[model samples]
Target: MGEQNPLCVNVSTTNSTTEILSRYDMINWVNDCLHTHYTKIEELCSGAAYCQFMNMMFPGCVNLRKVKVKANLEHEYIQNFKVLQASFKKVGVDKNIPVDQMIKGRFQDNFEFVQWFKKFFDANYVGQKYDPMEARESTIIWGGTPPGPSRIGHNNKVSASRLVHATKPTTRKASGLDSKHIGAATQTAGGAEGGGSQKLEDLTSQVSKLKTKVDGLEKERDFYYGKLRDIEVLCQEREQRNGKSVGTEKILEILYATKEGFAVPEDHVEEGAAV
Candidate 1:
């Protein structure tokens, strides 16, 4: 199975140690060719670059599991794992193994990767197959959604204070509600002039009503007093025409002695005309 992988050269024995040494020579040659090729695959896995060279190399030929180094300059070593066994044989050397059992391992599943302990492990294959966001969670790196072409995740909630502003009303805490009564005299009541004018208007209306009532009473009193003055004038005119009045009496004649007999006036008048 290791021979079919092609990352390592297939070697067969000639029953002579000379042919065994020939296999060693083939292994060294193959390691040199694969050296750069292995590095190429690694750069693709670690970068955003897609694996454009996957077609040229054998599938999974960083040996898939990296424990078998594809290129080791130290020993001139490379790993050759079997890929397929065909009864339809070719000129190359290989081992016979079933495809099903060999293909069982996956490039996904971090638990399997930890167990693998292979260098140059599948990154892009591992990351895409499992979510990169999910992979990041295994380590200290924050797991998050990949950005779009705009380099921003859809549905990401980031409240940027610089870009936005505080929505609450911008009032100073020192400015408290003014509950003071304002009507009598204050700037808030449109100054003292406004309040005083309204009060003066009300008082003027009351004073006008009181003056109207006083005028009506004075008119009635004047009418009664004029009638009393007319009555007193009529009585005085009647008193001037009579002696004193209709019931007037003479006090002097009555006091004298001439009035002792029937009437002193009758004596005086009758003596003159004694007959």
Candidate 2:
């Protein structure tokens, strides 16, 4: 069978939204905030919408030109996130962007982060009527191409030549791996060196893939842990105010059992499962 779509996954954990906002509610909130047409929460992974969000809240904080609005590759996504993170730090927003998990477009992780961001937005937004499209288009780069010369201005406009030069990779002069030495080495041990280089590359690729998988798993674990912690806090608050009922007791038992190294009673487990 094929792998499940991340966008299609209906996350069933305790919602991070205070008002128990549904997926559609969060999606709509994002769309409304950024003036976007995003249908799925996974579309936020590009980080473009987020940059505009920051720009909306804190004007001139994010350089929209740096944000890749149509990021398709992982590296492009990273660049967009880097721009977002820099904007956050610049504006003293003490939040970490989970770039690794977000780039993978996981529903749960992305949704949780977006939930937190929405709360932050509510707290920080100062009832300003900001045009997202204007802000984005003011410095937007389209389809990996820099703006034309006619668009250059004294303000936020970047020259086309500068943009092209920035994107172009610099050529580094090799010390020992010069073409003359390479030819001599190739004549002596060409096949052996080529095979060794291929093997090294393969091993590096495998290591990178494994590292990414580990990062995703760690992010998932932290995401679930945070949800449980939120639930625990809510339960504690409820118990203090209204007192615990059967449902609270069973849920608390499961949560406490996780840390106390004790087994939950089978009957309580079954009851919680049924609930």
Best by lDDT: 2
| Candidate 2 RMSD to the real structure | 21.6
lDDT agreement of model 2 with the native: 0.59
lDDT of 2 by residue, 55-167 (tens): 88788888887887867566778899999988876766657778888876655667888877777777677789887778777533221211112122233123222332322
Model 2 TM-score, all chains together: 0.45
Alpha carbon deviation, residue 43, candidate 1 (Å): 99
Segments in model 1 whose C-alpha atoms lie over 4 Å from true places: 1-192, 246-275
Q: What do the candidate models score in CA lDDT, each in turn?
A: 0.26, 0.59
Least accurate 10 contiguous residues by lDDT in model 1:
142-151
Flag clash pairs in model 1.
1-82
For residues 1-275, write the lDDT of model 1, one tens digit per residue: 35553333333223342222232233232223222221111111121111111211223322222222222121211111221121113323243332222222111221122222111122112322222222222221111111111111122112111111111111111122211222222433354375677765665565556556654554454344333323333344355576355432232112211322332222322221221
In model 1, what lDDT does residue 8 have?
30
> Best TM-score goes to which candidate?
2
The collision pairs in model 2 are none
